[model samples]
Target: MRRAPRRRGPLSTVVGIVLLALMLFPVYWMVNASLQPTGNTLRGGWFPLRPDLGGYATALRDQGRNLVTSLVVALGSVLLSLALAAPAAYALARFRLRGTDLVLLGILITQTVPGIVVANALYGAYADLGLLNSCLGLILADSTAGVPFAIVLLHTSMRSIPGEIVEAAQLDGAGRLRVLRSVVLPLSRNALITAAVFTFLFTWGDLLFALTLTTTGTVRPVTLGVYQYIGAHTNQWNAVMATTVLAAVPAAVLLVVAQRFVTTAATDGALR
Candidate 1:
């Protein structure tokens, strides 16, 4: 016998379509605006009738340095945050240390504070240490903001691993590091990739700390670089739109590449 087909309600279909359009419309507009002629962006005309690459070309040329800086800071932040957070996560996941829950809560609580408040103190500290306007300083600052979340996410993923696996590895006379390297690390790849992607995105899009910490275009990220188009006397909408679109490409690519891992990581983390 043939099964009956399921039917979606009118309101449900309408709401789904509306949500999809709402999400996609901005992306479509960004691409449309990026391809539009420089002068027509502010005219509020329909979507570009004759699109061109002139805006993209100008943005690439003007913001190339900033893009490079952003890439460096973001990549550096991801690497450092993951490196620092991973071992801590592993410990929390595998060990039964006293007050571990309290420690995790403390780390999570740090996220509640505004970045600006921390930035004030960080800026002064960076200046005192002669680290202002430096890529290393920015990398450190961005990593600090990202590490807590990475640790929490990674801990949850690690905790999902079966305790028996660790016991088996231990029975084989494996050392702590060996057991972690062979057992825990392999199982936690998805979580690591997710954490790295999230950290990269956060650092790449960070503006407040980037602006407050870095003084030179050589060190400032793409997010801060886009602001150059807005001067006291003039604003360049075409360039700004083009740059914003370009800035989003890396994040989009990262998500695409890590798409499978992200779902696994989130599920494992949430369930644990």
Candidate 2:
């Protein structure tokens, strides 16, 4: 199920490079702004000749706990999504059950629903259950998106596994769980990694649920922390930019490290 790489002309390549630069200019500006001196507005130069660390110092001093909270929530969401998604994906992929398509369609529909709607809907239930301002609540809130996404990606990869291989494992005394662990999961490694990375990114970047579910500052994630920071210190754009840059680090690192696996997973899902 390999896809052929399309050839790009030099002109097209140049055009792509230009387009990419345009897209990434804002990111470059963010880093540039973060390195600039504290100011009332974005007045950074084209390049930071005399980069400052004061903004980062301020961000770390004030929002360090919130960064940790974001990490905890994102990691928790990834673990929970994988735990729930792997088994569910296996069932959906391997079992030729009736209404599987319907179930998948339901999940797809959920993705289309706006985050605000889900947050508003969950607020009342979270309030009633006294789960507000709790890490567990945020993890659960984030998982609403992560789980279905993981299931979809993992299911696609698992579906590409040979049924004969699964059958052989079962005949060799492997239970369904055993087969999933030993056979399907190993075969779907790329997709699993891709799902985990994206789930972390999603949960890390989440703000709507953070705002809607939590009340007090006791359990704020970095996103909420940065949001409130902006309101409190409007003049300190450098600190705000620095905090955002720090927040984006994990996601950027994950994407760079796992990009090959993600590409392979996408190719498999598309071609096979």
Candidate 3:
């Protein structure tokens, strides 16, 4: 005879739903607040029964250029971080060089150093070199966050590649660079995507470097622009909240678009 199917506990399901709601409440509040009529946020109702979009219009008008600036900086940082970190990670994974562990430990140590310290030191050098107020300067500074984390991720993924596979490629007359380009990178696609996604997010949401590295309006990113909005237009809470919502869109869209690659990384046989 067939057995009855086991049922999940209703209590557990309800508790899970409650936790999910709690996690998502802030986002709901932001959307709710964004839709309220101007100057009504202080007494806005819980639901947006009558939504207004003037706040979004104002946000786009005011923050659009900064949004573009953020995209440029974030994309540049992702490229720079991956270009530098990928090769370093590959070397660390494949080579048996002396002090490889020490090198990696140093990278980890850099992560612990405060961003303010790095920015302070860089300010003097940038002034001398004239990198201040430039897109290139912001990109380089933002990569300080991306490079080390990406290196750690890519190194772990590359290390998990079967030694026999790499040896077989070498025995087949493929050079190290060719093998890495064709075999290692192809196999590590998920890891690369993971690194790229995170690097983009890190650079996109960065406010510290944008604030520290730039002084003029020419290169302001959305984070800094939002900060300025807060200071200059404190009464415009609806617009401010709308800008905050808009700033989150790219991150949300990226996670959705890259969900497959993320799942592959999580479940792939290599790390298992």
Candidate 4:
């Protein structure tokens, strides 16, 4: 027998809508502010009945390069973090190595350290290695934020894979590397996507490394661009808000596009 889907009551639905509206009001406010004329955002009305697109034009003209820099760094960080984390996660999950618990504990401990501390330390190293003000430096620094968490996420998911499955692969004359590449990775797609999404978001929104590692306008990320914009004591509030909205678009789009995969990754451990 099929079970009927449970439907929410009218009052519950109404409350949910109200809560959703409340949560999104800030976003609405940002859009409203962005559409207002320069220097008049504070006096602007709630809705943009006569929307002015000047702010968007200004933002695109001034911050377009920063947006591209952010995208490159974020994407690079995701690739590097996943490459390093996935293999470590798989090894830790499948092998009974000595001090594995200690290694896991250390990974967890890295999360407790403040990001500014990491940035400060990397600043000197980057300067010495001539990596300062470079996209590679930004990617390497930001990967720290994602690698540890990704390792944990992938390890937990990989552990739930049945022993028989791995053993069967080995019995079929598959080498360890082949088994991992052909079977393990294919089965952990959800977890990989989840980790990649989070890593991209972390790197895209990162400001510490972007600020500390770069000293010039040549390599500024959007976050640093926003910081500099507000610091300049300018009255162009609309441009500021527009840039912010643009910066937030990637995270929102990723969540929307990968909504199903993210939900499945959270609930499902691994391939059955």
lDDT of each: 0.86, 0.93, 0.92, 0.92
**Which digits, one per residue and each the tens of the lDDT, describe model 4 over residues 76-178?**
9999999999999999999989999999999999999999999999998998999998999999999999999899999988888888999999999998899
Candidate with better lDDT, 2 vs 4 = 2
Task: Supply the TM-score for candidate 2.
Answer: 0.93
Per-model TM-score versus the true fold: 0.91, 0.93, 0.93, 0.93
Per-residue alpha-carbon lDDT of candidate 1 for residues 1-272, written as tens digits (9 for 90 to 100)? 99899798999999999999999998988888787776647674557788778878888988888899999999999999988998899999899899999999999999898999988889999999998999999999998888998999889888888999999999999988998888888888998898888999899889999889987766778888877666621445676788899999989999999999999887776676
User: Model 4: runs farther than 4 Å from truth?
Assistant: 1-10, 269-272
Steric clash pairs (candidate 2): none
lDDT of 1: 0.86
Q: Per-residue CA lDDT of candidate 2, range 1-272, in tens?
A: 99999888899989999999999998998888889898953567799999998899999999999999999999999999999999999999889899999999999999999999999989999999999999999999999999999999998888878889999999999999899888888898999999999999999999999999998999999999999999999999999999999999989999999999999988888898
Could you give me the TM-score of model 4 versus the true structure? 0.93
lDDT of 3 at 151: 94
Q: Provide C-alpha RMSD values for all models, in order.
A: 2.7, 2.7, 2.7, 2.4
